[model samples]
Target: MTEHDDDRPRQPGRTVARSDPGRAMAFSDAVIAIVITVLVLDLRPPDTEPGGLLAGLLDEWPTYLAYAASYVYLAVIWLNHKAAFTRIREMDIGLQWANLGILATLALVPWPTAVIANTARTGNLADERVAVALYAIIGALLCLSWLVFFSYLARHPDLTHDHVDDDYFAHERPRALIGVLLYLAAGAAGVFIHPLVASVIFLVLPVFYGITSHGYDQGPSFLRRGAGSAKSS
Candidate 1:
């Protein structure tokens, strides 16, 4: 009688499951959308007299600034999240939890955003410091979540496809470290100095990450490889 493979404790070279990781991405995207929608809903209309619409809008620059900053932050997170998942071929329970951690941090963004807007409008440096500190804390948590997720993926190569090599981790791990350090520094600045400094730091990060991310190359290379295969066939 022929022996079945189920007798083994673990397969010597088990292939990653064929299920696409799109469902996770879709769920993440939906959550992100809802979070952003909630953020916009938090924006209160400026209290003004009749025929003062333009002046009212101009007077509420703080609200606009906070909204723009938070919006950009969310966009950057989504971009990096999409980039990371594109390289993944499979998922595990740990990865799912990491994703949830990130989402939880993101869900907290609206509160700080509202705080900053309210304090900015009031021109109270003391309250502004508190607001900035809160925002920076959230930003730090978000960066830490990303760091954890990347480190987890790097430590577990089996969760990813074959194209990802040691080089990928060597590159990504340091990148995550840099992000964490930068966020910490910004948080400190927010607590010690003017909040504007921290806001500038937060705004600058996406530009840095955009330029330096290894994730940018990962997605297109797969497309190139597939195109080459089609031509060869």
Candidate 2:
């Protein structure tokens, strides 16, 4: 639809002075770039003061694992972020604030990454478990923000491209729900099982997330209706 369309849908009890999202998206890109870089800089090299520097490097496997997992997870988030904006056509104050919520939680990712690395390195089973749990907690919050953002778009279709399916946003909610629930489950696994196992869960989750990031015209399998079925109002 053209920008001057008169019959644009809007949020109830809200004004409809939407603006282009170029500035907001550029700002978001900058924020994410800086946050992702922090993990790399946080990768401190193990001291080579021992009889062999090779052994010290080998002992940094935990560090490698934490950095790799966190980095890849952030990459998945970035990919999904780009995909989300492709459907967004306009920006409002609420949408802007919701985007900020994502950035806020994402910026803290490095802290938990460092915690996991250090705790695992010290060979502290209990602390490492707590570390993994903390990481999972942050991941859940991030996913929740994503859920809120998508839900907002679903409820306010005027903020998105006219060509996007009316039910598209509704169907996307399950992907975020899966993340929130799985992240919580990962936290429980960390507390009750091996921290390494929890980390592996964290690492594997991004694959599903990335796959689900793509849009579906009808919806996901579970959310899809039968052939010729009607969409409920």
Candidate 3:
């Protein structure tokens, strides 16, 4: 038998099955696009009764900051999602359910984002802590959903591209778990320490995950390879 990820004996009735991911991928893209659009729509121009345009804008820094950070977060998710699908050759019912779970978690991002911005804007420390805590939990759950998704993919090599090994997503699991833990920590910091600290953690997470989204040092592995080729050429 050729060496790959198929060394494991196939389970009865669980033999490899395949289906096109096109429709599902398209749906995912549409949903993610809508979420991003909604995030921006949540922003509003600051009231300008006494303050001028610049001051009004400045006063709404929390809103701008929230939008900026959330945009980057979604961008990272999109990038990683694109990478994951690129390595997936087919889809199964299990994969479809996992994907839906992930998307469901993602769809909820705008709520906490809006809460954080609105609370911070109001200068209400209690509300800010609550908002940050909510954000942290949501972020953690999203990370956990990714863990489930990856774990499912790891076990279901029949759904993966030929180039991917069984251990590929297994290795990725740790990174996802790290995200989960850090998010919980951020939430704790918000509740016990200070919301500003949690905000910093929120800003930092996307950078970490984005860089190692493919379980590598520099972003998605395939994209890095493509970039390396273009540079060498």
Question: Each candidate's lDDT (Cα)?
Answer: 0.75, 0.82, 0.85
**lDDT tens readout by residue for model 1, 1-233:** 11331232322465544345678899999989988887897577888899998898898988888888888778778888887886776677777888889999988999999999989889988898888888878877887888788877777666676556534543465556677778778867977987889889978887766654445334356643643454356
Q: Clash number for model 3?
A: 0
Which structure is stronger by TM-score: 1 or 2? 2
Model 2, 73-190: lDDT tens digits are 8888888888888888888988999899999999999999999888878898889889999999999999899899889888878788776876777777777888899999999998
- lDDT tens per residue, model 3, 9-78: 4446875565778878899999999999999877887778764988888888888899899999998998
Each candidate's number of clashing pairs is 0, 0, 0
Off by over 4 Å in 2: 1-13, 216-233
Cα distance off (Å), candidate 1, residue 10: 8.7
Q: List the residue pairs that clash in candidate 2.
A: none
What TM-score should be assigned to candidate 3? Answer: 0.87
lDDT for 97 (candidate 2): 92
Candidate order, lDDT descending: 3, 2, 1
Task: Compare candidates 2 and 3 on TM-score and give the better one.
Answer: 2
